[model samples]
Target: MGACVGCGGSQSPGVFVLEAGTYARCDGCGLASLDPLPAEGAAGALFEEGYFHGGVAGGYSDYDADGALHEANARARWALVERHSGAPPASVLDVGCAVGTFLVEAQRRGAQVAGVDVSPWARAQAEQRHGIGVAASVEEVAARESGEFDVVTFFQSLEHVPRPDRLLAGACACLRPGGLVVIETWDAGSTVARVMGKAWQQMNPPTVLHLMGRPSLAALLGRAGFELVTVERTSKLVSVGLVLHILADKFPALLGWLGVLARRPWLARLTLRYRLGDLVTAVARKPLAVVGT
Candidate 1:
């Protein structure tokens, strides 16, 4: 965690200390990460069934319960990629695609979609419920299929990994030349994040490895041989229960009440369309030419 995930630059502390952790900023690119990040083994465990079903700090709360909302969000977000891509993608690969909600939407729009997620439950849900192809890693997906995807997406999944740069490399390994890489994650430099200071929701460490902004994300894209395309604040539509699920971490007392509220069909059904501006969606393009090829 002391080194920048974007540029391999040394990091220094004293940036922001919230809760029981510290956020260290990279000296070279301003990328911030959880100092003393959780062990890789420990971090890997965060993406299990519970993570998708309300067992972890940053995981979803009744993810399947709000399937309609996720679908709507996916509907809106796929537009973001399409508008920047110049054409509708024929094939798509999604990294860290938990339960494949987004891919399910992409498939509806007439694209062949595949996913890479660490959670077995997530993969099962994606395949069994939606018939979307799901794998455990980019390498596994690349082994069977090489350089065929037209677009690769990482919606709210990049920050969960220990090495964002390495993850980008793995993503590009499956992309055809000139294919697009789309990302959506927390932006540390957003106005609300700056105003919230240590209280920013995305500051949850170990769960979110990097607090990346536009520049750092762009830097990571450059390092991965991607030409930056677009980076902008994005919108989301989420349910009320999902909000409670996110807050359950700092206030575990709410979990029991949350379970009760979730049982109430009316309360669980409430959703809001928000543009809080703390999150960004980025798109980059892989080059048509490579040294080896």
Candidate 2:
């Protein structure tokens, strides 16, 4: 293992191994990242059509299957954004805005919203289904609308980025002064991760490149000219059927049983919202004035 990506700390072997890759933890930042990180295009490959439908190991069982549930979750996230930064930002940009669920909710709250996703299928769905402007990358959006956004979000997408520093820099460049950046990512220092150890379902390779804790994340935000506002754990609502389906992927023998339950209309519709204290939501603001400039 080399120096830590988030913080230049001495690296030691981690407790988990996935797909022949070893995860190493940094003594300085507590980020557990895959050694010999995935290739340039590996992250993009995970967002294909089969990812949402469970053809892949680290993806959702049926992402689009729970439309109402997803929209409800999106609305809840929007409420959080409003709680921290106030309602109806002048403009919002969603990085890795898969299918634009959050973008739609932001629009509903009266923000001019746009999104960018690496997956063509997702981008198309965001544009055609939600009628929101979707681009392939922040660079593309910046070409047209630089420093014009009031809020930029990375909802469950920052962990997948190979270079988070670059991602934050690009986001900062695209934001107006005092703009807010919202991030939701898995925390490596959480109790659930410590308890599960290597068996944690999220410790997979190629899909999850980095696991960031609050302190490391705050430092990253500050380096990119953002002031950390809040860091807290957030809950997500997932269906019982979806949970079973995800479990089935790891325990193949349970697939038959889980499939049966997943088909039951009532069981499939049951939703639970709980905080595992493993996921962190950090809200940061770009400094009102550039330091030393």
Q: Name the weakest run of 10 consecutive residues (lDDT summed) in model 1.
A: 37-46
Q: 106-212, model 1: which lDDT tens digit per residue?
A: 88889998899877778888888888878888888888878999999999888877778878988888999999999998898899989977767787866887899
Clashing pairs in 1: none
lDDT of 2 by residue, 183-293 (tens): 988887899988987666677676778878887797678777788899998988887867786677666788898888888978877888857899789999988875784
Alpha-carbon TM-score of each model against the true structure: 0.90, 0.92
User: Which pairs, if any, clash in model 2?
Assistant: none
Worst 10 residues of 2 by lDDT: 14-23
Which residue runs does candidate 2 get wrong by more than 4 Å?
290-293
Best by lDDT: 1
The deviation in Å at residue 268 for candidate 1 is: 3.2
